[model samples]
Target: MNGRFDLNSLPMCGAKTRHGIPCKRKGNKKNGRCKLHGGHATGAKTELGQLASRANAQKDFPDWFFGKPVKTEYVIRALSSYEKLVELMLADEIDWDTVFDVVEQDQIPLEMLKYYIMFNVTPEALIIIQSALDTYYQETHAPHLAFHVYAPMIVFHKFFRQLSAPDREYLANWFKKYSSRHPGYNW
Candidate 1:
């Protein structure tokens, strides 16, 4: 038998042109298209091209581009929990000592505090929470605790903006003082 393969037996591109003629380009082995005829045309090379590609991609998969909306029930539940905690604090039911103990013992997560800030709880409630956290920091001498409590205030500036001007300045000064205690520690 002959060792040579016949080129005429290979498949060609089925793409048509404006004149209703078949594309003369050789088809890819797998996809049946030449490179110039979209055999392996990956989108975009430059940064601008990438941006345009992303924009087009968003149109195809919009939900992936824009995150899912938050459920109203979840928001209500979070707000209610925050309100109850604040009420308990204001009513003198939960003192600083209890708060400190619960936090130090890991019964309550530090992330809960971050969430309170994220939810923009009442300014009065925030002041109370901050004061309790400051007391805990002083008594426990935990730099991490102080950082965790204050870092959110600075990082989420929108939450800080909700505070009065004087409150904002106070927090800024407090952060400066805390950060200075550990030289070279900047957050």
Candidate 2:
């Protein structure tokens, strides 16, 4: 049985574009893409993608300055530190200058943050990154930089959230077990 309906089944709106294809499929009330292309623009490719591509294409970091060091242990340690740094940044507001001070005093470079963001970043990391930026702004009372970072952070967060699975299964399981364990939320 053809479960689908024809486009003609719906009311016909005046054609917007001859070249532009029908916005809705036949008999299918929900809107969909035309024959040629896939579904509508997902809004996945954002200005950040353009900026990253432009920056990377335009400039190359010094090899030793950016890439993993010769010592495997150092590379591993640096990676671990990178995760810790991101987590810490997300957990609370912090002094950017204080962080840099530690880096300088310890002889560790601040470029590490930049590199981690650049190379190993996933969409989830952007949340922490934006939090870190907010933390910096809150600590320093700098609205200017915070304003700049906000857009990219929001964009990345939206994209990531869309891709993430809802905790439906986990929550369902939890509720089932939870109700069995405790009958009421209130004592």
lDDT of each: 0.52, 0.42
Per-model TM against the reference: 0.30, 0.23
Ten residues in sequence with the least summed lDDT for candidate 1: 146-155
Among residues 3 or more apart in sequence or in different chains, the pairs in candidate 1 whose N, CA or C atoms overlap within 3 Å are 28-33
Candidate 2 regions exceeding 4 Å error are 1-69, 95-98, 105-117, 121-187
Top lDDT prediction, candidate number: 1
Off by over 4 Å in 1: 1-85, 105-119, 145-154, 158-187
Candidate 2, residues 1-187: lDDT per residue as tens digits?
5998665666543334466755343222344334333345543364344444544563432221223333344345445545665755655675567544333331122222433443466646545544544555566564433212211221222233422243445545556776787877632
> RMSD for each model, in Å, please?
18.1, 19.1
Per-residue C-alpha lDDT of model 1 across residues 1-187, encoded as one tens digit per residue: 5988766765788688677988887776777776666555677875335545655664433232123443344345435544544655677466666656644543123333434444475556556555555667788886643223211212344543345676567667766776788778877
lDDT of 1: 0.52
Candidate 1 local Cα displacement, residue 91, angstroms: 2.3
